[model samples]
Target: MSDRKNILFIMCDQLRYDYLSCAGHKTLQTPNIDALAARGVRFSNTYVQSPICGPSRMSFYTGRYVSSHGATGNFVPLRVGEHNIGDHLKPLGMRPVLVGKTHMIADQEGMKRLGIDPTSEIGVHHAQAGFEPYERDDGIHPDLVLKPGVKYNEYLKERGYDGHKNPWHWAANATEGAEAPRSGFFNDVANQPARVTDEESETPYMTRRAMQFLAEDDGETPWLLHLSYIKPHWPYIAPAPYHDMYGPSDVQPVHRSEVECEDPNPLAKLYQERISARTFSNDERREATIPAYMGLIKQIDDQLGILFKFMEERGQLDNTMIVFTSDHGDYFGDHWMGDKDFFHNPAVKVPLIIADPDPAFDATRGTVNDRFVEAIDIVPTFIERAGGTVPEHIIDGRSLMPLLRGEDVAWRDYVISEYDYFMQPFSPKTGRVPLECRTYMIANSEWKYIHAPGYSPMLFDLTNDPDEFVDLGRDPKFEDARKTMHYALADWSLQYRQRETVSEERAGQMVGLEDKFGVLIGYWDENDIEPPAQMPDYASGLENG
Candidate 1:
């Protein structure tokens, strides 16, 4: 509302790059999201910093990789002192507000050590990934303990939708069946309507609240709204009309090869055994569940239309910058995998669309960028748009403004994505060694290299095997390519480890500034500083000498 630019960042959970019509899915159509691409820049090769939820979102929020932020898994709290987009934006007088999920875990130990009260204003921001939370709902992880009157649950009660018995769980996730009473049973239910009506569903609720925030905004200062939606992740069910929109016929053929599954990478085979992909191997299960996944995505597209219209009516489109992306991608049985935890494109590659309404970007609008971008780039992008200087040492990402303006600039030739499976309950059960629980992926347009400490590195040649059904890691013909990639990975790791060097140098420069400016702690003026305690004997001795 102030003349300053505003940012509306919309992120969906577990959304794949190829799902949207604009991204070229032969069957599924997302005209609303596609329309955004038609008027903006759609990046084809964008990747997230991690393949899982909490770490991925943390990377996006902080503009730092999982290793830098140290919130490597779900329910792992972000370190309290780490800076985020909110911290960077504050210097520019902008507030980054959250409309939905962040999946941020509070650093209880850090908070206690710092003597910061959990209920205080600053404490809440510190714990919630540095966001001044407008409304925080991590979107009902099936394992979360739900209580009464917590935002969404309260809204359900007020709306007269009693979720069978557990209103919140039943409405958002449960199906009407014998399995309805079982906690987390709906996660495997497919092609069925949720217990709540379409209007009462979680997607619609988040959309409506986001719109309300826009309408209630007084326009006093430029603001950023992280309108994050938690749907299309799991509990593969949608409300009536959306639930039945797609069926078995719409499910894309699984892009997997039997040979790869037969002799998979060590980590890959272990993950396949642990997740729903193992269960969905049955044709009937894949068909039933894939369509439900499509339905959930369709519902999201419809809600985006509503949000876009609201922005248009408010005459905010011309002055606002809209960015749409996802935290990660669902494997959907790709390579015999289900939930994201692998470096496959289906699990790590996500759609990234940026619509800058500023006139300077007119030439690049509607263009597709093949340049490599990662989730860490998001916060820096927003900071640059808000007219704030990005702290290079603190933020590991580069701004996309140069590309948005159609300027020719040197861009990174490769991107990095990693995942840590050590925290999973199944890790110990599988007899996985400590090093085996971690994996790192480095890739470029031509080759992708995956390194797991205890196993042989995996390599995929994108030009030949686009589906990544073959492993060239052990193949002699690709030895040169494999070696080159391994060196790149090593160089990247070393560079990342030095990110703190610049910050330390900057901190060192401030060592004498306090002395130059005169510390007022023990003095009111020059006369007050003339005491024996304040004056050093060396000062006069040096002059006499």
Candidate 2:
């Protein structure tokens, strides 16, 4: 086996922080994921920069906040010049490859202006969020005009599935029934097994692709393989045996309260009124949906077992680093909400487990780290581990290598998550203008504060109500706490490092370069600054002229 380091970044869509057995999901036992956690450090309070998929993933890829990247919503293109994990890792001779979803939409306008063809090799990576994709599947094929799942659909057709229509919907996303199978898109039928077999499902298919990529690797170059899985997300359907793994008995009580629904802030009320939220709030819908959700997770765990065993057999595990995390969490009827787009823990906080092959990380193995970490930290961690310097000014997050090694470091006290809901239905319904349809959440271990431009701020005392049943946003009694959070948000916002073109060292070097060019200003005398030796006596030339 080669001594070069490799990183396998496994991301599961909509897998919540508490859904894994190691994370204390009582009924949903994930032995494969649990085994990974046993040999790794599980970050308990990890939060994403955004609760939504696209922005959260952009943050993870770029190591910058959503506002900084300016891709604050789904399908929003990341600006053309933005640096991502691929861009950063390439300089260190590490290749970053993608096998699944990134939720990345290319900045077509920016590319066009720069005269870059979309079909070019560089342009393809740019469009794919800086990844050389082995097989990129976002996994949502609804028979739409522009079908993004062309590769997966073709694979399904090649396997003797649907030939003419969208097999992703019928064979993979629909539930088996006595009559014609029902669409899994409906929560009512989500409990039924998918029409396809487990091996052919989306999870296993992606797993196979990842395995193929690893098997074909030349092994000379260090690589970071992003094995992203788009499951346990929605159209909540799981293939057989896993479909019946857990029933209603495994479903936990929904984390919501009448108090929240009765008197919610405008944003909270807007989310509660969404059709998906209302559907999830119903007992029958949740009962049907959660079982299939758990089943999908179990299927993912099994697939991970297969992938790990393959790596171990190939001796790849000896030098590879494995990271397991989710883009964001699902609300799942929490706080009277269904899908994620808010500040609640269920929607924002995600599970992060890192298993480094180096024996140095064994000290913190199987430990639960309560320190606040964010999605942005992953990029810097990878860069640091690959023997590259972390560009602190360009990347907003600190590397977690120290935390993994159980070293004492100055950790962050608060984490921020942002949401852009301009494209969501609630924005127009609530009469919110596009620019004002943003919300920023700042949270510590005890309190979480959400700031909406036109709406009253939402605050939750996590110390008292970890479930977040009550809102203290409009409460006058907690004025001091609210003020403190506001100040912290302001401090963080003011520190946005937008000047990426100039490094700190380069900026310092720039200080005297202008003076060397004789553009000196406000200098009382030439002696005030030690002129460079190359700089001749310009005064003598002036006098001679």
Against the reference, the lDDT scores of all candidates come to 0.83, 0.89
lDDT of 2 by residue, 174-265 (tens): 86567776788877777678888988899999999999999987878988999999999998988898887888889988898889967789
Once fitted onto the true fold, the runs of candidate 1 whose alpha carbons sit more than 4 angstroms away are 141-144, 161-165, 178-188, 429-436, 496-537, 540-545
lDDT of 1 at 383: 87
Writing each residue's lDDT as its tens digit, candidate 1 over 146-173 gives: 6444688777777775644356676667
Scored by lDDT, model 1 comes in at 0.83
Error of 2 at 20 (Å): 0.5
Worst 10 residues of 2 by lDDT: 536-545
**Could you tell me the lDDT of residue 49 within candidate 2?**
99
Clashing pairs in 1: 163-167
Q: TM-scores of the models, in the given order?
A: 0.90, 0.96
Strongest candidate by lDDT: 2
